[model samples]
Target chain A: MARVVVDVMPKPEILDPQGQAVAGALQRMGVAGVADVRQGKHFELEVDDALDDATLHRIAGELLANPVIEDWVVSRTP
Target chain B: MRIGVITFPGTLDDVDAARAVRYAGAESVALWHADRDLEGVDAVVVPGGFSYGDYLRAGAIASIAPIMTEVVAAAGRGMPVLGICNGFQILCEAGLLPGALVRNAGLHFVCRDQRLRVETSDTAWTGDIEAGSEILVPVKNAEGRYVADAATLAELEDTGRVVFRYVGGNPNGALADIAGISSADGRVVGLMPHPEHAVDTLTGPSVDGLALFTSVLRASATT
Candidate 1:
């Protein structure tokens, strides 16, 4: 089985409030060990290499991410 | 006004946006992401959906397309522009609007009918509605959260640049209830909700979204 991995992140200019809030919550919970938290997304798909990069890119733009707020990366293994 | 709907490879709502423009008495022209010409259209719409597959970033890859380069120039020349969802992302990527869109607090895909107040309606696309008027539209997105720095947010609020505010009681919890925004000159508008989905009374969530399209009609007619 082939393994596909995806990682998502906010654009550099965009603020990440959720990550900030979580860090704040961690601090409030008396956990001082956390330094920072930037939230993102990751996905893994098991698929054959029959799909080309263009087709896979189309899948990324069509449904996996909003394109407005998030970015994604896809990798496949032989 | 002849409106051009820019369709990137993964755009999901260009057809709907085009239909909404037609319903508003404007001719909808199809524009491809790679083309440089806008075909003399009076306005341009960067419709919603995944462009370049949200790879690299939402609107990031599509922002570099040749057509977007021209769209930016035309926007500089005062052509009215509107972006919804993914389109909003591209606008930011292209630097036509300030700030950027970020992830939702909950990290889950959200889909539902949303309520939004007309925070600023002096825009070319929103002028028909009075400020503070509430309207409903459909919002379906995974990264629909709107994030800008405190300074920028303050500036937006002080200048009344905000075009729409989320009505808060949504089925999905979106922050600050922000739904849309406009450019400094009110020529460019962007929003997270799918106003096109609300254009038809029979199949739409509410006719409230139609006013946005109609407002453009009024602006074009008066101009």
Candidate 2:
């Protein structure tokens, strides 16, 4: 089985309130040097050998992530 | 005319939407997310709710549901479709509308009686309402802020696709006070306010929201 992982994040220009809240909590906890934080989604898929990279990418783009507000990265995981 | 109200797993306003349809003198049909059938309804309404528990994004998960495929095709063929609140989010996620609904600027779920001005009366959903008419309705959501690229915003302004604008005060801090918008052909509309909730004075903030459903019925009659 091939294991694939997907990381989806808000666009760079979009506002991320949840990420900012997390960053604020970290700052209050005395964690320094954090410029910003952008929260995102992570998904892991175990695919059969028959599923090609193109199919995986299609799933990520069309089903897993919304292109309007999110960008996704797909990679093979060990 | 029959209006279809879709119900996803977590849909909360399907009943209200159907009631609004009936109040406007149209038959209401119930559609299921898992079903591919559209039941030949003349129009469709994607009612509000926390569909799919809003897991990935507000409307991201519900956008790909089986019934949306038919809705999208029908919308492309100039069928009227209205998306309210979470329904608005789902429409944006499905690429049936422009922009995306994000978290409110205050980062809290706002629930209140909201005032809105009808900016355009060209849409299939707002044709009965006169331009510049102000109405009160209830809006409730955590991710009701609307955003799009600068160019798209400009295009929407230039084309008069802006259907509704927030008035009195901006509840969710939507960009440019835009409360709702319509497609280029005026067959589709999406908004963050709950019009169905305001259709009855006995149970809601006001009866102002009934105009939207009545407008569709009137438009259907003329066409």
Candidate 3:
């Protein structure tokens, strides 16, 4: 079995209101030195070792993230 | 005329959408998400709700349902399809429409009577209304902001595909205050507001939304 992790984030040009809200809260809580915050999704999947990287990429690109508004990175976990 | 109103597991507005179709003097057919058949309905309406609990993303799962495969095919042949609220998101996710509906700029669920200007009445869904006329409808959603890349945005603007433009004030911070848009052929349309909920004055802000339903019926009759 193999575990894959996909990290999806809104594209740089897209607005991230939820992330901004978190940034605001952090400011109120007296946290500093933060440049900005952008929210995203993280997905972990367990699949057969035979699953190829191309197939995994298709899954991540087609289902895990919306290409129109977000970008995703897939990495295998040990 | 017969119109199909699709119901996914978490759909909340199918009944209301069906009722709106009936009020427009058409028969409403209930369609299931898992079914591959369209039941020979002249048009389809994908209504609002958190389908699949909005897992992954709102409208993401539902957009790939068995029914949508048929919906996309039918739409390709120029069949009229109207997607409201979450349905709009599904249509975008399904690539039936251009752009994506994202978190509202305010980051809050907005529910209110919104005024929108009819940008173009050339589409199947807005044919009964005059272009530039303003209509009041109920807008409700957390992720109602419409977003597209700059090129797509320019194309939509250049081609006059924007169907509805927020009139009074933009409720969701959608780019260009776009409340609704249509496909290149104008047979497919998706909008964030709840036009189904506004077909009657008793339940909605105005009877203006009835025109959308009537418009499709009129389009069907001529075709």
Candidate 4:
């Protein structure tokens, strides 16, 4: 079996209120030098070793993330 | 006329939508998410609810349901389709409409009777009413904020595709206070407000929403 990871983030141009809330909390907690924060989703999938990268990418692009407002990256883990 | 109301696993407003269809003096047919048949209905309504528990994203999972394949094909042939709340999200996910609905800017679930200005009477679903009319309907959802790129937004505006705009105040910080929109051909429409819940006098804020159902019935009859 192989493990593949997908990290999905809101497009930079889109507003992310959840991420902004976290950034606000950190500032209130006295954390300094925090410029900005953005929130996203992370998915780890276990698939057959024979599964190709293109298929994994397709899954991540089509189902794991919405291309209209998000960007995703797919990577494999040893 | 026979109108089809689809029920996905987590759909909560199918009954209400069917009731609205009946109130409009049309036969209501129940359609299942797993079924590929439309039962020869003239129109389709994708009602509100947390379909597939809103997994992945609101409407994302339900957009690809077996029934949607037929709905998409029917819509492509100019059959009138209405999508409400979560249904609106599903339509956007399914590429039946433009833009996407996201988490509310206030990060809260809003539920209340909202006032909306009808922006256009050109769509199959809005033709019964005059343009620029105001209607009171229930708006309820967490992920109702509408967003699109500048070019798409501009095109929607320029083409008069915007169907409903929030009046008094914007509930979810949706871009340009857009509560609903229509396809270029004016057959498919999706809105975040719950018009199905507003078809009755005793239970709804106003009877204004009934016009939408009547409009579609008339549109189906003529076309």
Candidate 5:
């Protein structure tokens, strides 16, 4: 069995209000060193060792992340 | 005319949608998400609600419900389909519509009587209304902002598929003030606001939303 992790984030051009709200709260709490924060989603998948990268990519792109507003990174996990 | 109102597990507006359909002089049929059959209704309404507790992204899980397969098939054959609020999110997730509905730009749930301009009357839901007419409807959602690639926005604008636009001001920071849009064939429509809530003046902000249900009924009568 193989494990894969996919991190999906809003495209840079899209607005992420939840991240902005969290960042604001942090700043109010005097976290001075904090920069901007963008919220995202993470998914862990367990697949057969024979699963191909193309199929994984398709799953992440078509079903896991919405291409209209999000970009995803899929990487195998040890 | 008969209109099917689909109810997912967490659907909150199916009853309201059916009420609107009945008020518009059409028979309303209830459809279950677990069932693949569409009940041969002339049209369908995917009402608003946080289906599946809105986990794993809004509408992401509900879009894959068994009934959506039949809804997609009916839509492909030019049957009118109206998706409201979370239903709109499902449509986007189901690939039946363009764009994605993300968290509200204000990071809060907005609920109020929102004014909207009827941008296009060519679709099955808006044909009864005149172009550029303004109507009052309740808008309520936590994640209702519409987003899309620039190219898709351009195409929607160029093709006149934008069915409704926020009139007074931008409510959820949706790009270009778009409130609702139609598919390329103008048979499928998805919108963030809750038109079903405005179907009765006694229980709603106004009766203006009844036009949407009547429009489809009128269209079916013509054909």
Candidate 6:
């Protein structure tokens, strides 16, 4: 079995309304210098260890992340 | 023919959702929020409603419902999961699917007969339909805008995972024009539109929404 980890995020074009809302609340609470707030999810993968970085990257980019608006970072772990 | 419809505290649509399922010739099994059993149903519908009263965030609380354990497990086992407005919120909150449903970008309670284009019909739910088909359904929500990090959107679009998109009149989020998306597996589908409200031709803007349910039936048979 080939184990590949898929970590996904929202696209750039899509708005992180929750993060933006919190940022606004923070600004109102007198928190200064909050340049930006982007929210995303992180996943830990336990893969077969046979697939190379390129193949895994293909899955993450092509089916895992929406390149137009989202970006992802893939790493290997036992 | 048995379909499980879950009811969580503050859920306003579970009854109607059950009725719609029954009307569609399937037995509707009412599942409680705190219960973990699915009652041996063939499929599941996480119907729309104001679960947990949209507190914290819509579907945020309901996502953790006790019954959600079974719902999530069943969904993973290839049971078709359809999340409506609030249900869509739960799916994202539960991490069953990606993206969050935030308040409408304009910050107003948007209620209207919205038109949608079915971008992909190849899923455990939408397998009977053709891509690019137009569907008219009702949408009512104060917080229904979908948000996610950039990379997630690309993967959804690139893989035909975006099952539905709003008609071209309004751009997505007013920031851009995105409507709804699905996971890599077609079994789980999340969309902002309310297909339940449009299931009956006489009771809705159109009967096109019935196709969504019937499509699921077809998908189930094919599977």
Q: State the lDDT of candidate 3 residue by residue for B78-186, as single tens digits.
A: 9999999999999999999999999999998999999999999999999999999999999999999999999999999999899999988899889999999999999
lDDT of 1 by residue, B47-93 (tens): 99999898856787887799998999998988889999999888977
Error of 5 at B186 (Å): 1.1
**Chain A of model 1, TM-score against the native?**
0.74
Q: What is the lDDT of residue B160 in candidate 5?
A: 97
**CA RMSD per model (angstroms):** 8.0, 1.4, 0.7, 1.1, 1.1, 8.9
Q: What is the C-alpha DockQ of each candidate?
A: 0.12, 0.60, 0.93, 0.83, 0.82, 0.06
**TM-score: the better of candidates 2 and 4:** 4
Comparison by TM-score, 5 against 6, better one: 5
Across residues A27-74, which tens digit of lDDT does each residue of candidate 1 receive?
999998899888887877777667678877766754555454567888
* Segments of candidate 2 deviating more than 4 angstroms: none
Residues B111-153 of candidate 5: C-alpha lDDT, one tens digit per residue: 9899999998898899899999999999999888888888999
Quality of candidate 2 docking, DockQ: 0.60
lDDT of 4 at B208: 84
Residue-level lDDT tens digits of model 2 in B73-124: 9999888999999999999999989998998978889999999999989989
* Residue range B52-82, candidate 6, lDDT tens digits: 7876457867887888878888888888888
- In angstroms, how far off is A2's CA in candidate 5? 1.8
lDDT of 5 at B106: 82
Winning model by DockQ: 3
Q: Determine which window of 10 residues in candidate 3 chain B has minimal summed lDDT.
A: B194-203
Collision pairs in model 3: none
TM-score of each: 0.76, 0.96, 0.99, 0.97, 0.97, 0.74
Error of 5 at B172 (Å): 0.8
Which prediction has the highest TM-score against the true structure?
Answer: 3
Comparing 3 and 5 by DockQ, which wins?
Answer: 3
Error of 5 at B176 (Å): 0.9
